[model samples]
Target: MRSFVRVLLGLALVFAGTSHLTFARQEFRAQVPELVPIDEDTTVLASGVAEIGLGSALVLASRRRRLVGTVVALFFVAVFPGNIAQWLNRRDGFGLDSDEKRIARLFGQPLLVAAALWSTRGGSRQRS
Candidate 1:
C-alpha cells in the first residue's frame, strides 16, 4: 500500500510538473520579460523537461528511495525561488487567477515538499 501511494504521488508530481512547462513558458514570458533577456525559450523548455524527468525518476527509482527523496527535496528547494518571485512581484500572468489563490499556491510549496518527503520515507519503511 505504501509503495502504491508513493508511485501515485510521484506520478502526480510528474504530471503536474510536466503540465506546467508550457504554462510557465507562456506566463513567465508575459509576467517577467527579463527571462528572455537571459536566454531564449530553450533554457525554459530545458528546465521544464528536467522537472518532468526528475519526477519520473523519483517514481521509478523505488529501490533507492532515500536518494529519490533527497532529489525531490532538493528539486522543491531549487524551485522555491520562482515561487517567491511570483509572490513578491505579483506576476499576475502566472495563471494563479487571484491574489488569494496565488498566496495559497506560494505557501503550498513547503507542504508539497513535505508530502514528497513523507511519501518517500513511508515507502522506504514499508520495504524494510
Candidate 2:
C-alpha cells in the first residue's frame, strides 16, 4: 500500500512538472510570489525540472528510498509558501480560484509531505 502511494505521488509530480513546462505554465505562474527574485517563468521551469527529478527519484531510487523521500518532503515544504502567497494575493491557479479553494489546497500539502515520508518508512539498510 505504501509503495503504491509512493508511486502515485511520483506520477502526480511528473504530471505536474510536465504541466509546468507546457500547458499549465501560466496557471503555475499564479503561484509565484512577487517577492521572488528570478523571473516567474524561469522559476516555474526550474521547479518543473526539480519536480521531475525528485519524482523520478521517488519511483526509482530503491536503495536510497529514505533519502529520496526526505528530499521530496523537503521540496514540498519549500514550495508551500507559493501556495500561501497565492491565497494571500488572490492569485488563482489550478482551478483554485476562490479563497476557500486556495485555503483548502494549502491544507492538502502537508498530507503530501506525510505521504512521502510514510510510504518510504521501514526496512534495514541494504548495503550498496
Candidate 3:
C-alpha cells in the first residue's frame, strides 16, 4: 500500500511539475500570490523545478523517503498561500473560476500534505 501510494504521489508530482513548465504554465501563474515579490512566471518556473526534484526524490531515494515526504509535505504547505491568493484575488484560472471550487481546493491542499506524509515515512512501513 505504501509503495503504491508513494509511487502514485511521485508520478502525480512529476506530471504536475511538467505541466507547470509547459501546458499549465499560464494557468499556474494565476495562483501566484500578489504579495510574492518575484515575477509570477518566475515563481511558476521555480516551483516547477522544485516539484520535479521532490518527485524524483520520492521515487528514487528510498533511504531518504521520510525526508522526501517531509519536504514534499512542506512544499504543499508552502504553496498554500498561493491558493489563498487565488481565492481572495478572485483570479480565475485552471478552470477554478467558481468560488466553491476554489474553496474546495483550498481545503484539498492539506489532503495532499497528509498523503505525502502517510505514504512515505509518517507511519507506514518503508517499502521500496
TM-score of candidate 1 relative to the true fold: 0.74
How well is each residue in 45-87 modelled by candidate 3, as lDDT tens digits?
9999999988888888777788889999999999999999999
For each of the candidates, the C-alpha root-mean-square deviation to the true structure, in angstroms, is: 3.5, 1.5, 2.1
Tens digit per residue, CA lDDT, model 1, 1-128: 64566677678777666655764566643333344345635545665676677778767875677667777778777767766666666677656766776788868788767766776776324441
Evaluated at residue 12, the lDDT of candidate 2 is 91
- What's the best-to-worst order under TM-score? 2, 3, 1
Clashing pairs in 3: none
C-alpha positional error of residue 35 in candidate 2 after TM-score superposition, expressed in Å: 1.8
Alpha carbon deviation, residue 66, candidate 1 (Å): 1.0
Worst 10 residues of 3 by lDDT: 119-128
Model 3 CA lDDT for position 86:
94
Task: State candidate 3's TM-score.
Answer: 0.93
Q: Using Cα atoms with residue i matched to residue i, what is each candidate's TM-score against the true structure? A: 0.74, 0.95, 0.93
Each candidate's lDDT (Cα)? 0.66, 0.90, 0.90
